[model samples]
Target: MSDAATKSDAAMKPGWTPRSAWAGILSEGSFGAKGPAGVTATAREDLGIASLIAPEDGEAALSQVVKTRFGLDLPTTPRTVVLAGRALVWAGPGQWLLVTENRTGFASDLQALSGLAAIADQSDGRAVLTLSGGKIRTALAKGCMIDLHPSAFPVGSAALTSIAHIGVHLWRADNGPNGAVFEFMVARSMAGSFWSWFSASAAEFGYSVHVGRG
Candidate 1:
């Protein structure tokens, strides 16, 4: 007997369609020991994302345009402002990531503000997932380095950090009946890697998964 096999037989193979890379591995159901669910994960594949870059020394002008257009005061720090189903999330100095369901509408609004800031669609390059429930914070803590304590990363808080070496933008949304709410924004290429770490982290408390229709 030899370890090598003849070419006639193929070893077990793993594959994914160009767009549905994570689909084969994830099922829409609960995993781990069953009990009262401590976490729920939902895909936000339809989300329209874009980067808003303020022109040099045009911060004030950018603020005015965003204010008049979306009735939003651009977040100057790491925070999230939700208005009319859209979130203006601060990414860094004079930069923000806009998340919404209607990308065309959002792009139009950005056009109204483009005179002061640069707008680029980020939808295709980003992967977003909404995570919620009682044990979210604890599960997140397993791989995230930041302090998730309410007093530290309270609701509306957002940050660009890493999980298992994968870069991610983590943010805390309003609390839900189950408990806290949060979302992760990661590069499309690393989504599978990120989820692997997340699923394991969440398994201890029990969790559910929902793949988006998109």
Candidate 2:
């Protein structure tokens, strides 16, 4: 069957409304004219995410498959690696999360690692949030227990932890004056609660809310 036919049939099938998990909480909001001193918050919806579990001692083989196919290396504990169009975050021992802009066939693509790994689609199960700017770490520190100091969680690092009591997969994507962008994935059902906590934490330094594509 053609890809178009598959897509058409999926669309024609009955389903619930495609509203964002953060539809009610995200929008144009700012504390001041310039918004937060040095912080910008963006929410991206419908991103492709998959959970990968590689067999014991198969991390190397799995990494090879990822590197060959996606041009990215499967990161080890507490790290995230980004390629031209995809990113891989270490989720746990022998487990990783794959993120990409295109959700189509993502989970299937990992079949290259077939005998060595297992894949599960989490595209609709979570929401992506990005926090950037000079004071971004400060804002995160308000509600998160993790040490945001550069010496500790440097750029290209990832952590599976909780923020404001909400579980999340967090990672630092960059570092610079206008850099230091951190991307995190939170459960769809907890997006609203996370937003509430984020807002309160960012209030002191002010903040801007951005909706739509990340």
Candidate 3:
């Protein structure tokens, strides 16, 4: 192989281990495991997050651009939709958040598109946590005031809400045999606090904490 190819391969090699914001608090111990029904919350760091802001008059055009680039349309309502390897989450009237697992450099790619959209990388600015199990909704109800009934916030629904006064971008990512799996994206600074609140609220129902990459 050429020297340039060899150097490129070397540069792409994995390096030192990186730590997530929640690394300090997440432990691999059983906290709520004695109950009949239990919840499992996992903290992951492998998700890429990006915020998209479109111009007042550029919503339609930007939506098209997103569709053309990601093979997914921007969700117009408060919902989450996934296509290929990415998810488009409605954040506001004209704004959306882009998320992907194992997809890096997305923010830069989004920014590169010439349009009325403003793209910002939030992969490091936010922490993602996934909650699953039969009692997931019940546990979240302790602090979150949203109606999370299967009929209300059904799978693929996304909402900008608050839990214990901390703002959170929440969505029902999956629902099947394992029950509902809710994903929470919170400010990195509030990750520890959010986890604390979630754990405490889930204690009565019996829960397990799993920490890993997205």
**How do the residues 99-147 of candidate 3 rate in per-residue lDDT, one tens digit apiece?**
8875576656566555668778788788998888888888999989889
**lDDT at residue 59 of model 2 (Cα atoms):** 84
Off by over 4 Å in 3: 1-18, 33-37, 105-108, 112-114
lDDT of 2 by residue, 113-180 (tens): 57768888888889888888777788888878878788898988888889878998898986645877
Q: lDDT order of candidates, best first?
A: 3, 1, 2
* Alpha-carbon local distance difference test for all models: 0.83, 0.80, 0.84
User: Model 1: how large is the Cα RMSD against the reference?
Assistant: 8.5
For candidate 2, the lDDT comes to: 0.80
